[model samples]
Target: MFADRAHAAPARQDPSLGSTDDPERGDVPGWVLITLMTAGLVVLIWALAGPALTNLFEQAIARVSGL
Candidate 1:
């Protein structure tokens, strides 16, 4: 009997990514991840540094006013 090419596997599948068949399952969309990380970092920096900045500004204003 002749060999059957019909039952043969596909030529390539990436090992780093197991399969690309399910596009939705494995990876987060780049824009969505970047937006989330940017928002989180903004909130973190604001929370940590906002009060200090405000106090510094108030001190500068007080010094300017000679009070």
Candidate 2:
């Protein structure tokens, strides 16, 4: 109920994060690391595969254009 919620004390934030910051916000660093690692993997894979993929595409286009 609205009345019960209004009467209850507010939840406490984590002490190390400063008083205004929520404890649950800690997961952002982990998510950022995961996103950075995924991006690095994508770049590495593209670097390794880009020339082969381009060659394959050119061959396919050449066959079609010849037809």
Give each model's whole-structure lDDT: 0.86, 0.87
CA lDDT, candidate 1, residue 50: 100
Report the Cα lDDT for residue 9, model 1: 77
lDDT tens digits, residue span 1-67, model 1: 2356767775886689766677756556877899899999999999999999999999999999999
On a 0 to 1 TM-score scale, where does candidate 1 land against the true structure? 0.54
Worst 10 residues of 1 by lDDT: 1-10
The estimated TM-scores of all candidates read 0.54, 0.60
C-alpha lDDT of residue 44 in model 2: 100
Task: Please write out the lDDT profile of model 2 over residues 1-67, one tens digit for every residue.
Answer: 7899998998887777675455755677889999999999999999999999999999999999994
Indicate which candidate wins on lDDT. 2
Return the clash pairs for model 1, or none.
none
Candidate 2, 21: how far from true, in Å? Answer: 10
Candidate 1 off by > 4 Å = 1-28
